[model samples]
Target: MQDLAIWYEGTALAGALRGSGHLYMVVNAAHILGIGLLLGAIIPLDLRLVGIIRSGPIGIVGPFLSRTAGVGLCIALLTGGSLLSVSASEYLRNDAFRWKMALLGLGMLTIAAQHGGGRWRRAVETGVPDPRTRFLAALSLMVWLSVLLSGRWIGFL
Candidate 1:
C-alpha cells in the first residue's frame, strides 16, 4: 500500500495538483458537490424504501433517485482519486481513510445485493417493499452515513 501510495504521489497528475493550491481547492469543491448529490438523492430514496417517507410511490421514485446517485458516485470517484493522489502516502496512513474505504465497499455490495434480489424487482413493480428490500434499504442508509462520517474523520485525522 505504501509503495502504491508512493507511485501515486510521483504521478504527473499528482505533481500538478500538489504544485497548485487553487486547483486542489477546485477539485475538493467538486468532490463535495458529488457527495451532496449522492446523499441528497440516496437519503430520501432510502427513507422511502424503509417506509419513513411514504408519500410517493417508490416504483416511480426509486429508479430516478438511484440513477442520480450513481452519477454522483462516478463524479466523486474521479475527483476523490485526484484528491487522494495529492497526498496518497499520508491518506494511506490515516485510519479514517481505511474505514471509509471499507464502509464504501460494504455499501456498494449492499446496493448490488438489493438490486440483484427478486424482491427488489417485485417491490418496484408493486410499489411496495418486501422485508428483504426494507432490510437492504435500512442497511444502505447506515452504511452510507458511516461512509460520509468516516470521510470527514479522514480530514480531521
Candidate 2:
C-alpha cells in the first residue's frame, strides 16, 4: 500500500496539481461545492424520511434529491482522489483518513441497502415510510455526518 501511495504521489497529475498556480485551490473549492451539494440535498431528504420535516410528499422530491446527491458524490470522489494523490503516502498513514474511509464505505453501503430494500421502494411508491426506512435514514444522516467530521479531523490528526 505504501509503495502504491508513493507511486501515486509521484504521478504527473499530482505534479501538475502541485506546480500549477491556483489549480489546487480550484480543486479544493470544487470539492467543497460537491460536499455542499451532497449535504444540501441529502439532509433534507433524510429529514423527510425520518419525519423531521413534514411538509412534502416523499415521492415528489426523493428521486431528484437522490440523483443530485449521486452527482455530488461522484464529483467529490474524483476531486478527493486527486487531492489525495498530491500526498498519498502521508494521508495513508493518517488515522483520521482511515476512519473517514471506513465511515464513507459504511455510508455508501447504507445508501445501497436502503435504496434496494423493499421498504424504501414501497415507501416511495406509497408515499409513506416504515420504521426500518426511517431508521436507515437516520443512520445515513449520522454516518455521513461522521464522514464529514472525520475528513475534517484528518488534517488536524
Candidate 3:
C-alpha cells in the first residue's frame, strides 16, 4: 500500500496539482459543489421515500433525483480522486480517511441496492413504500451523513 501511495504521489497529475495552489483550490471547490449536488438531490428523494413528504409523486421525482445524484457522484469521484492523489501517503495513514472510504463504499452499495430492483418502481406505481424501502432510505441517510462527517474529520485528524 505504501508503495502504491508512493507511485500515486509521484504521478504527473498529482505533482502538478500539489505544485499549483490555484488548481488545487479549483478541484477542492469542485468537490464541494459535487457534495452539494449529491445532498441536494438525495436528501429530498430520501425524505419522500421515508414518507416525510407526500405532496409529490415518487415515480416522477425518484428517477430525476437519482439521475442528478448519479452525476454528482461522478463529479465527486473525479475531483476526490485527484485530491487524494495529491496526498495519497498521508491520507492513506489517516483513520478518518479510512472511515470516510468505508462509509462511502457502504453508501454506494445502499444506493445500488435501493435502485437495483423493481422495488422502487413498485413503490412509485402504488404510491406506497414498503418497509424495506423505508429502511434503505434511513440507512442511506445515515451512511451518507457518516461519510460526510468522517470526511470532515479527516482535516482535523
Alpha-carbon lDDT, every model: 0.91, 0.91, 0.91
Q: Tens digits of per-residue lDDT for model 1 on 14-114?
A: 98998999998999999999998888889999999999998988889888998988888888889999999988999989999999999989989998999
TM-scores of all candidate predictions against the true structure: 0.96, 0.96, 0.96
lDDT of model 2, residue 153 = 99
- C-alpha root-mean-square deviation, candidate 3: 1.0
What is the TM-score of candidate 2?
0.96
Report the CA-based lDDT of candidate 1 relative to the real structure: 0.91
What CA root-mean-square deviation does each model show from the true structure? 1.0, 1.0, 1.0
Each model's number of backbone clashes? 0, 0, 0
Compute the lDDT of residue 50 as modeled in candidate 3: 94
- Regions of candidate 1 where Cα sits further than 4 Å from its true position: none
- Which sections of candidate 3 miss by over 4 Å? none
Model 3: per-residue Cα lDDT over 1-157, one tens digit each? 9999999999998999989999999999999999888888998888999988887888889889889988888899899999999989999999999999999999999998997898978987887889999999989988888888999999998
**Model 1 CA lDDT for position 21:** 92
lDDT score for residue 95 of model 2 = 100
Tens-place lDDT per residue, model 2, 25-126, is 999999998888888888999999999999888988888888898888988999999999899999999999999999989989989988895887788888
